[model samples]
Target: MAKHYPPLPISIWRHPAHILAFGFGSGLSPKAPGTVGTLAAVPFVWLAMQYSLMPYLIILLVASLVGIYVCDKTARDLRVHDHPGIVWDEFVGYGITLIAAPDTSYALLLAFFWFRLFDIAKPWPIRVLDAKVHGGWGIMLDDIVAGMFAWVAVQLSYLLWQLF
Candidate 1:
């Protein structure tokens, strides 16, 4: 059976945290909000790519920290823990996936696929963390781990491509 969620309140637009936690409205999508939010992050990732890796990592770090607060706050306001509409974690996760990726469209696309796969599959420790944790930390940790898993996959793939 499909799980049902209550419709979001209009106040999501009026609050800065809500706006960001929702991924600038990308999370408002009625279907697959997480995927939409992740896709929405691609442009920002591209923009981050314009700078050196140091800057990109710093931005990713800040975003991850902020995401914990925003996601927790949004979920608390909604009286739901880790509501589906709260997708700031996805944004941070996708960012982590591409930290060392080449500045190419194909690399970005590949990273996206890998990140989504790990996120959705939630293998081993990712699944364990998702189930065991709670609050903002819980909301972000699983995706962060997913991003790390995807990062390894992406880096290995790139290395293999170079070797051939």
Candidate 2:
């Protein structure tokens, strides 16, 4: 059965939290909003690459912390828990997946693939967290875990490429 959600008011665009949580309109895509939101994050990842590791980490930490609140508030306002259109989690997840990744197009593409794979697949404990957790923390935690899994995959892939 197809699930029906409440229609989002057009005025939601005026709200800062809605703007951020909806990924600056990337999440408004009619299809695959999560994928579009992740792609939207690619440019930010490019910018973050200009910073050193500590600064990049700090930025990501702040983004994650802020994401929890924005995502929660948006969900509450929409009266929907973890609505598909709320994709700031996807933005942060993609960023986390690419931390310290090589500043190359291929590397960026690889990280994107790995991040999407883990996020969509939601293996093991990620699935556990998704099922058991709730509210904003629940919305963000599973994707954060997926990002960590993708981060490991990206690093290992780079190491292997270097070795060969």
Candidate 3:
């Protein structure tokens, strides 16, 4: 029974496990947890932009590697694959999307919506990849693809805005 429930603390935000398990408290949101998790990534994205592209990519790569183990472990503990509470993949995915956009409220909101749409819809290659992949990579890859699409969309939007 305990394994079935996501481990919670008296003060969920203060719990280290909760922060890790819930993707920095994003899962605690009353609305769609995944969306919340993606939204929560904006601040990190802002901070990451301070560095060069190479460093950002390195950080993402490291997160991907670590996310595999950490996500898998957390999922196993909760006895579910891609549990809502285990939102690290969403965080990473959104980070990837925001990497391509400038730091602005409009860009952030656009990236968020686009990423969420692709993620929830699981269109095309995204669906195929999600089905074929397994473990943490599986958990993260679909979102990665979604983030790619989101990035592309943001770029297009910027281009269109400039043209008009």
Candidate 4:
């Protein structure tokens, strides 16, 4: 059985916070850690959707604040900048994508896939920002940009699908 752990600044695999922040080792997936991390966020979104937006926003805000430090520390420990296992950025990015989205399984899944696509594509500004920015904020900003792109795509898809 998989053991639940939390995010922490020290040892990543052992820390409960790190484990949760890394999406229960989904981020550790050999291929496309970011993709796995974003996918892992789907359940949290479902739960968050049950609560008021304010509370959800609050949790996202806290993660954003701590992500800076945790990301940095994890990167240092892993000997890589913005290591894939340090996927708190993906968590926040997915949260952004889901903002105001309908509370439906399909909607959440759509947002999840779209966010993952944009994050991987890293087009235009997202790629530019990812390259230019540095440190925790940089790590977070690329995902944020990707999330914004995904958000737009989700809205457009929703409208178009409704029209059809």
The numbered model that scores best in TM-score is 1
Query: After aligning candidate 3 to the native by TM-score, how far in Å is the CA of 151 from where it should be?
Result: 1.0
Candidate 4 TM-score, C-alpha based:
0.85
For residues 17-132, write the lDDT of model 4, one tens digit per residue: 56655667788776677888887888877788788888878887887878776666566565566666768899889988987789998888899889989988889999889888
Provide the overall lDDT of each model, using Cα atoms, as 2-decimal numbers. 0.91, 0.88, 0.75, 0.78
Candidate 2 regions exceeding 4 Å error are: 1-3
Maximum-lDDT candidate: 1
lDDT, model 4, position 84: 61
Candidate 1 displacement at residue 106 in angstroms: 0.5
TM-score quality measure for candidate 1: 0.96
Candidate 2 TM-score over all chains jointly? 0.94
Candidate 3: C-alpha lDDT: 0.75
- Which stretches in model 3 have alpha-carbon errors above 4 Å? 1-18
Cα RMSD, each candidate: 1.1, 1.5, 4.1, 5.7
Q: What overall lDDT, based on C-alpha atoms, would model 1 receive against the true structure? A: 0.91
Worst 10 residues of 4 by lDDT: 1-10
- Model 2 sits at a Cα RMSD from the real structure of 1.5
Cα shift from native, residue 118, model 1 (Å): 0.6
